[model samples]
Target: MLVSSIGASIVQTVGGAVKIHDMSWVTGSGKTMSALLLVPDGASADDKRPAIVLAHGWWNNKQMQDSNYVELARRGYVVLSIDMYGHASSDPLQEGHEMDAATGMYDGVKEIASLPYVDTTRIGISGHSNGARAANFAIPIDDKAATPLISSVYLVDNDPIYTDETGKYVNYYGDRDVGVQADQYDEFFFRSYDANGVALTAPRDYIGTPNAQSFLHFGADPSGQAARKPYTTYTQSVDGRDAVREIDNPAQTHPWGPFSKQEVTSLLTYFDKTLGAPTAIAPGSQIWQLKEGFNALGLVGFGMFLIAFATSLLGTRAFAGLRAGPAPALVPREGRGLLWFWGSLVVSAIVSGVSYWIISANTAVGTVSFLGDPPINPQGAVWIIALWAALNGLVAIVIMTVSYRVVGRRTGVSLRDIGVLPGWRRFWQGILLGAIVVASAFLIVFVLAYFFTTDFRLWVIAIPTFTPNKLAIAGIYLPFFLLYFLANSVAINSFNRFAIRGREWGNTAVLALANGIAPIILVIAQYSHFFITGELISGFGGINSIWLFPIVVILPVAAVVTRKIYRATGNPYIGGFIMACVVTIVSVSNTLTYTR
Candidate 1:
């Protein structure tokens, strides 16, 4: 089916040439797979056009290949950006989304190469992160992927996984065109590059690493390996075909590498070299970011519309039972309390920055790629993040309590006055009404996405409509996410915004700003090093820049809506419950998950 923005493409017959289509067909696994396929205008399968299959990292979907798909397709290859099993619109299997990338890639290659329009002999495969792992699986003489259809392979942020000291695989990569792009500061990257575990400070340094030495032989001299350390190309004769091989290490992190112009252009350039471009366009000229903007805009529209729908439904008769009724049981609120405004700013930033890197650093998610399947449970990354959220929530509650109790003990403000003390009737009512109201808005949006074959997204931040498996995953993850959002809402509403001195709008403005901007500033600070100095700033590893925009979008909205919901229903429970539900559902549905 032609879904969402997959049909969106630019048909430029001149130097600009690309037409993108979104569709899914049955794979050999008999599961449906989704892809964004771009063909150069007027090119048919009969055209024997060179083709490439692009895949994204672990816990990510097809959109992560955004820049590559746009740039490569424009350069005249039929580009297929596919969602791996258990992601996006692709039908989920019982297990093995990342582990079985070979099956999926081979499925695409067999179907694509069989097409008369595509040159079966010139097909290439590309992937980043775990997708790169899958791409590695597609090559070599391994049983998982023995596809002769692959003429070349492009690896981003990864090295050949199944390899020996000489970088020898089951034995087919020596005959194919290969390119490897590694980022300087990817936490998991250097493990494959260096055997003794020393990180690379330069590109060509990879030529000296453990299994990385395998890339040196694209028909090049073994003595010249040191000179071809990273970028300087080396080629050798493998079965008489020019098995052109190249490697580039750039100044970016693992997550942000695919989106960067320098990295992505390097990616496009490699394809242009091996796959052959029809028109000679400059390597760096790109407009894929504009499409990314459209996707972001869709997310904004989706979020704002949801808030509007929920707010509107509160006024309707079907939800008449939920209209503002009574107050809730409050803890205890005294006179005008200390806002802890500056304290919050400092603490939240410290907690966020420290937790962001520490949890990841301590977990197997960091270095568990080859550790015998790594026992997939809560996903080391997910568990760490969940712990991070719960800890932050505890901090928020503690800080809010301390400030309220210590600063002012004057006049009495009951649980009712502070707005948490709603009756039992209203407490349960909030949960019931909030669920119904939030679900209604979501169902409407998801139904539209279902028929349209798309989800609300902006660039890499995606909120796809769920499959049953994803929904089930969402349910499993809900309590953990709730631990974060519920604490956040309660803190912001109950204490963070307590004792407002000015007008309601001023209070709203301050609270919203306070709630949202800290993370935005911190996120931008981490990425500033990337944009300005082209390096990952210390203490903020594994932080994907894609989170910057959406967090900025949703946090303020979370504050505003929580305020509105609290005021309408006169309690914090309902508002917190609703916000938690929406946040968890949006987050879980959009991320990558493993089948357990």
Candidate 2:
């Protein structure tokens, strides 16, 4: 009853009820895949609605097409959003822990067909990047009865897997309609590849070659292959059937395309033409933003809950044993000087960026970095991030030591005043207190989710409680989180605590920037390049966008909390523990990890 009300409320917020469900099905290969199905209003089991299967690219999950789902479901088409193999909530392969992406999409098609309110004859498959390749792979396959499950397909900013050297895939796609929405300024797909698949001459012109021209024209070599065209539509015959083909060359870059209206409209236009009978809901008339905005509101609620939950307990007589010691006076309590002010930010960015680049490469998968088991994926990105955290902390220590020890002879600083290092007993007490705080927060969140069947989620941002599987994984990864936060707390507390000539706010602002400027600059540079030059920065394209803002916000927000805790307890450990545990839970719960 609670779940139904919650779901109803979310639907109303997004406009109206589009009956949504979490579903699972076993593939032909015995692997269980997870998916979300959105049923249109007023559709009975007997009224089979045209269905579309939406799959995300590498490291992404079902919510990648949130806009599409909201809009499409309102238009009366059943939408099935799947978490591909070895990702999110799917049952992953234990045999090598690696499975082909195509298999998941193939099984997703079958799942949509299994639904009572879905029309098996009117299914459309769509994917972005690697996911587009998967759709290309799955749509061409014959089911058990030798019938095609997908009648049409949409490929977003990627080459199809079926497009073999001999034009075999194009020949196969001739039976149905296909649409290509390639950003002309795609960093990797368009410019980074030659006819021979070598990664050379990047930022190359998109339409300046015979191979690309032929691809743009659906396997027919273009007479004018020497110039770029932003939009072209064509209809041709393949397999003795009229096949409609189109190539759109939006001037946008690759990374931001999936989330944009142009991309969604192009997709909707393609599906309408191919599938036929789609309701005419004009593009851009969407209320999904309200849902996303609600998510942001809930995220703010999450932070407030943590602060209230932790700070209130700390004030209790029972928890008073974990109180902080007195803060010691440090060098130049006025500030770390102008030299240290700007220097720390620049130094931290370079150190952290360089460290992340080198170390994460050893484990990153397909331009995305994280911790992985058999191979790197989004989860691997998580692991890589955790590793980067540790590396960053170590660098902070070295830099702090060097700045104090080697950089000055008369710095008026000693080991004793370098922030609070509570006595060993009190330190252990802080650890215990931190653990309780984490447990309390989780208890509250878990109850809400378990009983109400709701998570504090808004759009792409979420604060979700973990399942048993994820909780176990969190245990393995939590210590690394603690280490990073501890190092960060120590460095920021000691170095950033120096007042800006008694202007506490100014000092805090600088400190916050010092802590988070690396990611902030990285994101800024990445987006700026695409906007200014119309080309993606290539390497940071994939998973970094997920946590970009949230990850960076940690420093500024947590710095304030850390300072307050330091002011109260004179111990960085308490702040570090609390922040680390909170962030870990928030990130890990929301992220898609291997269910296996």
Candidate 3:
């Protein structure tokens, strides 16, 4: 059936038992917002039923919440789903209006609670996608501050902001959803506290803060069991009991599936359990239940097996010998000594570890202390540290393989012919590269901080306030950026050399294609996360945050320009420097303009 027709008929089919009303309210900021409210059949002014407020995902409207509304109302609860700012019936406000919409949602909830039949004491809020993020932000605000409202929260399929050592968000589905992280909500809550002081942050520090509970539900089944593999079944020790939670649903995606019969049953069960209904449902316990399914050993073993298989394939005689045919002649001219390669690899690994530590420290969650204090759980700590070390080692191996491919091919030397650099040169070069990397990272951080922090003036031109954490973050970003730049330059240089041997049109065509396609790929990767789940990168508000779009576009143009310059100069180094400068200038200018 057509969507419009389906919507119109839904309420009618439910009859006068439920009253659906569309309403608008003005926010504290003077923005008018629109919402849909469902009042159960014969809900008297004195009925005092629990109410749920819903927030929709990106590019979606209140109708998306209709399924949940029907289910909740059938369970004898009132539900309200609002169109966030700039969406559906709500007026367009500004960029990041989702934040404002969240405030407005609280206001509406307050209005709902005041109605005689609605139980003010038993209120809850739930959101999906961007809505989910807004809900997270709303719940942690001090009950006495700003809107002065509080409610239990349900975040669906959204990542909260928090980071692991690798600069990845710490969650079961860290990169799985692209947009939201499990730790993000916590980070935002903490940062908001830091910015607003104790008045805003202190009250909402824990799970049951302000007499309200917050819960998260990430849909487990997508693409049938295909998306559920590895994470599908496992065992966990919960409350001293080894329990298993298997994900049996085959239809759910990033967000919970619409309130189908099964979904309604599950959701009602969860709400009844969490919201003080008579029959206790164990729905909210699913998160813990699901965690039982994660088999760390199995995951690691599978990864190792894959690595072994790949290494075996790459080491095969046919592949190894094929590249050797034209390699010898190039070795003497293009090769860095074997020592240089090995030293560089070691330095890169050190830089990576330092950078990870630094970024983790600077963020709102602060640094993880390994040595200074005893860990809360020494055993878990040991495992995590070991995993990090192993990952870093893996990274070093990958870097070595990459270095071998580039240096070996260019210099016409086999990996076996590489030698160690002298101690002095190795030391100095490592220091120099490390310094350059650190400086570059600082520049990026300063630029980003200027735009993000309210106290931009303090650090924009003056010497930055360097805490151990800030320094650590700088250390991390610097080397990673350097290695990234070096790899990019080398790859382009090699590719250009290959292309130069082709016809002029073919070379230009290939360059143009690559330059044109790269940004498109990046943009797609950046925005696709929103469709999968309703969160965007912090600071960047997704495609709607179009401030970075120009920069993305300029990068391809700059690449083309640099390629041309390289061909003309026959010096890849010069071309790389010029491109780097261009990018830096663009970045700085954008930062200054936007931040100010």
Candidate 3 per-residue lDDT over residues 33-113, each given as its tens digit: 767777776567766688878876654456555556655665567778776664444554343344553635665666676
Between candidates 1 and 3, the TM-score winner: 1
* Cα lDDT of model 1 by residue, 545-591, tens digit: 33445667667777787877766655666667777777767665555
- Taking all chains together, the TM-score of candidate 1 against the true structure is 0.79
Q: Count the clashes in each prediction.
A: 26, 8, 30
Candidate with top TM-score is 2
- Put down candidate 2 lDDT per residue, 1-596, tens digits, no spaces: 23332543475224445777767677776877877788877666777789998887655566666667767787778898887775556754343333353648878887778878788888888887767877766754543337777778888878543346665434446566777777766654755455696555333355555445666566655665444354555666776777776666677656556667788777777777788645677765665555445545555666665556556667888667655556444434424455764676688879877765456334334233433563333355567677778777777777776666644325665544454456688788777776787787667666754443344554345565544566666666677778888877876776556656666667777777777877777777776776675555655653454446566777677777776666666667877888888776666555545433
RMSD of 1: 5.3
TM-score of each: 0.79, 0.84, 0.35
Off by over 4 Å in 1: 1-26, 29-32, 39-41, 89-103, 141-147, 160-172, 190-226, 229-234, 278-282, 320-336, 339-358, 361-380, 395-410, 444-454, 498-557, 567-569
Task: Supply the global lDDT for candidate 2.
Answer: 0.65
Residue-level lDDT for 557 in candidate 1: 79
